[model samples]
Target: MALQDQPAYLIKMRAKPGLGDKLFALATEGMEKSGSSDRFIIAREDADPDVLWNMEVFRSHEAKDAYENSPLADELRDEIIELLAEPPMRIEVHPYSALPDGPA
Candidate 1:
């Protein structure tokens, strides 16, 4: 998808030590219910195993909005916020193109 054709968001988070697994489980459940098939990337780059990155895509602004307003969204946000060691960093972007079999 071109930049103008897709809506995306990147949410970066850090969890308390030993909390990564729990967080990932909850996030997966939430995403599954969000009606979004967008892929995600999770990683740990520092000594702390808490660092995580979630990249999500929506077909359009309307689709994103609907997902955001859903009950699943509320549950997901609450679940994530409770597990965070700090507030998540969120960025919205428009993708120009997707890598082969990658984010689009």
Candidate 2:
């Protein structure tokens, strides 16, 4: 399938003060262990040190749905919520395009 047509989400999280680093670590760990994602990127906001973002692309719609309903995902969500100052915000989309690797 075309990468541009894949299911994706941009998630925004607000970590409790002094917890951004810990949140980033957990997010990175989750990405490394993900089985259904085509790509995953976790980033921190420079201006807002306690804010984090995650861009995730799933391999397919089914993959995304299965992952969302899985026990592992539930566990991860519960863990992540503990560090958040408020509920996460999620924006769902299909990617128009992306570089396979970051810009030169």
Candidate 3:
């Protein structure tokens, strides 16, 4: 089924030294629990060693809310918080449409 009204969220994090691997592992676990592996992306920017970017897409705001309210999500948030040097930066974007000729 295609998502009718999905929203994209961009999350930027500043991590402590050597915490990237742990963060990625925790994110994977959280995504699995939320049934959102298809919408999760984690990337390390070459320009900054302490910076990581996380992008998540959901079918709607309600889906995002549900994931956030899940027990597994709470546990994952706590674990991620402990590993981060500061709070993550999150931005929401609207996906207007998709291209017809390319892979989504």
Candidate 4:
């Protein structure tokens, strides 16, 4: 798909009760250390207050793969695992081809 047909890469996370906020915070912070992501959004599941999803958009497959394979990502994954009800699940999505002009 075209770069703009998709985000290049994404990570979908489902958080446990009372820990979504904390996990989200860590995820945001962790992204800075890698510096390869293009956009980040932590969304709460409307049906379940205790559930959350962290949507990450990368600049390219290589960038996303780099982050996924990096020590920083591994560190964050290990840390967040403790906060989850079960092991976090990962989903790769095709983001919108076009993003809004405002800050992502």
Off by over 4 Å in 1: 1-3, 102-104
Q: What are the RMSD figures for all models against the true structure?
A: 2.9, 1.9, 3.0, 2.9
**Clash counts for the predictions, in order:** 0, 0, 0, 1
lDDT by residue for model 2 over 1-104, one digit each (tens)?
99977899999999999999999998888877768899888888899988999999999999999999988889889999999999999999889987678677
Higher-ranked by lDDT: 1 or 2: 2
* lDDT, candidate 4, 23-49, per-residue tens: 778877887777887777767778875
- For residues 1-104, what per-residue lDDT tens digits would candidate 1 score against the true structure? 45457888888888777888898888877777677646555566566667788778786788889888888888788988989999999999866676768576
- Between candidates 3 and 4, which one is better according to TM-score? 3
lDDT of 3: 0.76
What is residue 93's positional error in candidate 3, in angstroms? 1.8
RMSD of 2: 1.9
lDDT of 2 at 31: 78
CA lDDT of each prediction against the hidden true structure: 0.78, 0.91, 0.76, 0.72
lDDT of 1 at 42: 58
TM-score of 4: 0.74
**lDDT of candidate model 2 versus the reference:** 0.91
